[model samples]
Target: MKLEHRIGQLLLIGLPGPQLDLMTRSMLQTIQPGGILLNTHNIEDAQQLVELTATIRSLIEVPPIIAVDQEGGRVDRLKEIYSPMPSADLFRASGDAAVAARMGEIASEALRTLGFNVNFAPVLDIASDDGANNGLKGRYLGSNLAEVVRLAGAYLEGLQHGGVVGVGKHFPGLGDCALHRVVQQDQCSLECGDRRARALPGLRRSLAAPLVAVQEHSHGIIA
Candidate 1:
């Protein structure tokens, strides 16, 4: 591989505008970027995204990976345009693996229709009642390891079947930090040994699905 290709592999860029289309095409042709991460800002409509992705991919022999944070509920970028998604905790509360699976599939379909190849989903972070919580509240499945495992598994399964590569995130347990505020957890030094144990079960389950990768959060270390 060329040095240009090697450098491109390290970038996970956000899609800018039409003016940059030529530049974007040139970069992909010359460097072959590793992936493209999308957000609500990039989403205008399903058709637009499809065209944009097609244009970008045309520049390379192999299509570049396209990623998005379409975790569902409040985190869903297409919530306003598509069906409303349930929170991860809701799936856990229902204890219905089928429901979780459906959610993932639905999310995957929505993303794929918009030309995305990857989804940052199935948050495996366990939530705690403590003030130092890191679960991201409604975004979390539940505090119970068993519930988290089941729900995340189902969600990933759906995404996989829909041809979307799922990514489980915020490793080492985000179960004990406050939301909104930037609270970091040192997973390597948590006093509560149970936190690691609780989070692992979900991580293991998430990985068991057809996932592409797992994101190590910026928070801190993982033992």
Candidate 2:
């Protein structure tokens, strides 16, 4: 492969619109991105989403990483086509591993059918000590390290069962700094030091190298 091709493969870009027009196709062919992220704007309905993803995959030379947030709740990009999923806190509240696993399975099956190989879900971040909304409020499973690990593990289990690669996100937990600061500013670790340290234990327990990379199967291959 050419150097440009290798560099292109490192990118996971979002599309400008739902359909891939001539210009978009040409850009994709040239870039050959490593992945395509599914978002609300790029989605219209079930059939359209399926077609969009399929077309994206076909346009690229190598197998690309088609990813989605798919954390359910307010973050559910598929709410238009599929039922809204409950928040992460709700699952943690139940303290049921099966529930978490089933949520993962539900998300995985849907993504697989839609041509998505990667799901940017199962957030491992523990809620902040201040209990501020901090961007990941609804997304976080819980603050308790043990419960967080347990539920996240169950969620990963569910995702793996459905043959989808579950990507655990926000490593070492990012609840300490406000979401805005983290997004807009650089080195925004305000009051995040002690709390982030506390959160590392849970991440270490769950998302170690072995757990993060589950399968190398052709179906859910990620770059």
Candidate with best lDDT: 2
Report lDDT (Cα) of residue 201, candidate 1: 53
List where candidate 1 sits over 4 angstroms from the true fold: 130-135, 179-202, 205-212, 218-223
Q: Which candidate's TM-score is highest?
A: 2
Report the C-alpha displacement of residue 181, candidate 1, in angstroms.
5.3
Residues 93-198, candidate 2, lDDT per residue (tens digit)? 7989889988888888988988888887877766745366456667778776777778888888888788888877664346554535434421325355455556
lDDT of each: 0.72, 0.75
For residue 175, what is the lDDT in candidate 2? 55
Q: After superposing candidate 2, which stretches have Cα over 4 Å from the reference? A: 179-202, 207-210, 213-223
Residue-level lDDT for 204 in candidate 2: 59
For candidate 1, write residues 137-179 as lDDT tens digits. 6788767676677778888988899999888876655666444
Return the TM-score for candidate 1, rounded to 2 decimals: 0.82
